[model samples]
Target: MKYDFDTIIPRRGTNSYKWDTPEEENVLPMWVADMDFHTAPAIVEALQERVAHGIFGYTKVPETYYDAVVRWFGNRHHWQINPRWIIYTSGVVPALSAVIKALTDSGDKVIVQTPAYNCFFSSIRNNGCELSANNLIYRGGRYTIDFDDLEAKAADPKVKILLLCNPHNPVGRVWTPEELRHIGDICLRNGVFVVADEIHCELTYGRHDYTPFASLSERFQQNSVTCVSPSKAFNLAGLQIANIIAADDEVRRRIDRAININEVCDVNPFGVIATMAAYNEGGEWLDALRKYLWENYEYLCHFFTERLPQYHVLPLEGTYLVWIDCRASGIGSDATTLRLQEEQKLMVNSGTIYGPGGEGFIRLNIACPRKLLADGLERITHILSKN
Candidate 1:
């Protein structure tokens, strides 16, 4: 079935976090990670059927929900998930916080790849954990993990958790199995538990494939906690559902307690229905969506190559977020974001929010219709051309 990714659905009046956040009219919001395209028809139909029931009550998370998750991962990613090992949560962010709370005490350190998803920082901070940056090396317009630096950080006794982002956001490199094995080995040797955030596992493009950190081996599985969801891939962020998979029973129990204490244990009914629908029937739609997103990325790359060659557009191996090196604009990242918002009515994220190594960079979301993406690129050109 052909998915309609070309239509520009009006979202401004609907209280969308991405669309309605900007006060000015004609503001193109290419910032937030959520896609502008509609979710799969299966998800919409499943949701509609539930809405027709009209009884919104506390959700019990039926076995079918677990079956859907287990089947999806087993079939799609070749990662067999036991239904007994699954712990449903409201979102990946909350799952990370709960896992941190369960595994570490206050003041213990959590290591994150620099220029990471900004929420990882907040999750660590909220759990009373200090953040240790194992910054990714930026060279030749690509990002690679600094393994020696990661090893040094992990060797610190205070560092209890390494928050690993597979198919890393903002930077956009999908870690290969070899890199992941090396990382797993270092964390294991250092007694640092791995918290793998694999939410973007399904969104890789061309030659780059996402490797589930825990799926590499039994030893890695025992030492890791993986948080996954259909939210990012299925455009279900608003549904607010995610899962934590732990092969170790004790680890799962402790994290479950933390989840209850943190008060994020409850999930909305829509999230459950949408997740099952997405996993079981949304594959075709997701593939189409990925193709559209890849095209958008190529178009953006071409645009930058032709009209804005000074600004470097980094290669994106996974996820729809594109990282651009904007140092040539002769302005800091924060200033660039402000100028884009105020002058051109375009909204994009400053690289600084993602932490160290993010300076003088900007992250753009290309998960929208081609026309809208073109408009945003033109808006960016209007502002950066002055430089």
Candidate 2:
């Protein structure tokens, strides 16, 4: 417990979109994907040491950076990553855009699951690709991929890529091994390249295991690209450093070239330093953070179940975000952002913004102090009762 996650660090006036909002009254911002906790101390020390060196000039990524990344996956996930197969990117979203640009032609079709991260759609469109969404089947108190529909879309000649959000956002389903295999088979048979956006890969919980899409099979690995980072797990989104693991040499070169074209050929020098430090030393902090987030989630679930039974928190096995089905609240409490900001004095993500399947749903970021969480929920209950 060297790093305390319970303290709420002030982020206002820091150009922090997560905490910046025009609230005439007090507001609790549980919106945005960023965490309230400070990053690992090891990461801070690494970056500060870099800053102390004083010369902020161009950086040629050292072999030490790559070695740190290789060692991380090798030790924790048991996924052997070759340093050569790794391509550095400024961030995961930008990396997604680059992959879409590199692997397919303009106007080619790309598939993504809806109630998904909104960035994948824009990344696809930004690359001039026609984006297609296969909304997940919300059955049996959990989310499942629509494989029959997925294969049908992949069967189309125009379809060239499938963008996957593993440990999926909004719904929070960690696609199991069997699911990954089915998805890999569909993409492979249909001449579609798989781009797995596993940025949330390390934050999973329960018995779920994450299989890197590229690590599924030889052909799948050859035709796929995996985008991952320590941003989510380590709360280092500001670092803007992510790795694009490409098993195929040619695909690696194409993705690397596209990243170069985007003017982020080299990321923040400190970002690289912090990334290496994180993968090498932040494991214990990440593990601790997961336990805290899970507890926070349980508290939120219990609060809603007893005090606000009109609403329901979606079953989550991953991510610090808790998706709430406020359809039963009947007060349109799911305006969620509106209700949270105006009535409850809290700020949360509105589901409708995530695309079609998001309506009637709201995403609450639970990566904060328990005191803050309890206060936010208390305010919510008071508001609901008045309504």
- Evaluated with TM-score, which candidate comes out highest? 1
Model 1 residue 199 CA deviation (Å) reads 1.0
Model 2 per-residue lDDT tens digits across residues 97-181: 9988888889899998888898887898888999788888877567888999998999999999988999798788888889999
RMSD of 2: 1.7
Query: How many collisions per candidate?
Result: 0, 0
lDDT leader: 1
> Clashing pairs in model 1?
none
lDDT of 2 at 276: 89
TM-score against truth, every candidate: 0.99, 0.95
Model 2's number of clashes is 0
C-alpha RMSD values across all candidates: 0.8, 1.7
